[model samples]
Target: MISRRLRETAVAGPFLSVKGLVFGLFILVPFVYTFILTFQRGSLLTGMRWGGLSNYRTVVTDTLFRDALKNTLLFMLVCTPVTLVVSAAVGLLLSSSLRGMAVHRALIYLPSLLSVVATGLIWKVLLDPEQGPLHLLMLRGFGLDVPWLTNGTVAIVLLAFITAWSTCGFYGLVFMAAFNGIDTELLEAARIDGAGPWQVLVQIKLPLIQPVAQVVLALLTINCVQVFDLVFVLTNGAPGTATYTAMWYVYQNAFNGGSVAYAATMSVMLLILTALISALFLARRTGADADA
Candidate 1:
């Protein structure tokens, strides 16, 4: 069958030729170019030189790179779990046949529909120190105006919160779908065994949905690590590089600051980190499946 297909492909030469051309131009060429440019030295504007491992060493040893790595990891640590928790809770609530559930779901999911730039701008205004609604409320309540985006620690936390609120709807939908896929009989069996709602959820539902949760976590980790748009629009890696994520730094070097080779190196590093995290999660899943 494989030999017959190959013979047929060879006979249908034009279509196959076009496909080969498209694949080379779209995938192979760009990948080879980017890989080559990663090792290129000199300013993006002036010229290109072969720098060997210098770009990699410079990026690794730079203090800004270290800070970006720390900040990116911290953001993921805060955002991923918070998103999963809030999303799972919301999914559970949505699964229940509560009153006005449609309205509740719509309202909860609304933020995810907004563009990240729009959401960031809205939050920036809302978090303004002098005249924002949240600022006024906090000032009245606590007798102080906290700089939501000005302070290093506070900015990081606030960025996480914004990311969580924006992404919770999408993850909530995923969890809800997973929740709905469970066999209804399992819940009845648990109840028949004198299991309460909490027990049924914790023991039966959660364990059954563990795979989905793991997928969500992996995706959330990727998103958190690659985050840039909202951070750029809101803080621009302010407060002395406190919110500078790896992607943010990469963007600065590649486009904003004209360090194309360095940006390419950072891009490769991010790819490596993402691949490692994805592999770890996949391995755990495979191991669990094998045991099962």
Candidate 2:
């Protein structure tokens, strides 16, 4: 059988490709180093020491890691759905033929152009409990001096929503392209067959864009689970470690607590956990969608 070069090249690599060399130098090397670091103890500052499975044992019994894992999963679940919905909605709006939609689309997508750190800094200021403009407005108008980054539940939810808002721009464009690629004739046919806008959207538009939705969903799941910078900038997993995500815990150990090897172990576990989650989500969604 003739091979699909694109398919084979995608999962493997091209012959004598610069990208392949770059991938080995960057992604492959770092991952291998991190894996090696997992079985050892100590950091570069204090020097390395051999420790076989001690890091694994520590991670297994660490209550903080367990809590962080739960929070990480919760963040993924919350952020993924919100991001998908918001992005899809933005895409629909962007795809509309409304007057000045170009301006609207650009404004909608501007957030994605900013770095995550910048986004986090902006939100952190806006959500300040006392000095923030948004906080003052809410307090005066709605009489809600909500603890934006203090309380655990509120902070986690806020982070998820903010992350969604930041991500919607990029994913919105992705979906807009998907929506644009949809054939106009099918839509016209549906309308002629007495299908309303809502019906057409639900039945035709959504199903046609399922593949893009799948990709977006998987990316969201992985990114949300591995979120770090926002957590770092906003609360530093504060309010008595209320917002301690898995990556935050790992960061604490790696950078601050001087347990690089231990953090590497957590990273390895996280890598496994993320793969399992992404796979499970894809499988379940694919099965359910097929049945549907």
Which residue pairs collide, candidate 2? Answer: none
Question: Which residue runs does candidate 2 get wrong by more than 4 Å?
Answer: 1-17, 281-292
| Top TM-score prediction, candidate number | 1
Give per-model TM-scores.
Answer: 0.91, 0.89
Worst 10 residues of 1 by lDDT: 253-262
Clashes of each: 0, 0
> What shift in Å separates residue 230 of candidate 2 from its native position after superposition?
0.8
* Model 2 lDDT tens row, 1-292: 2468867866665665878898899999999999999989877887999999999999999999999988887888889998999999888888889999989988998999999899998987887776888898899999988888878988898899999988899999999999999999999999999999999999999998887898899889889879998899998998888899999999999888658899999999999988997888789778977887
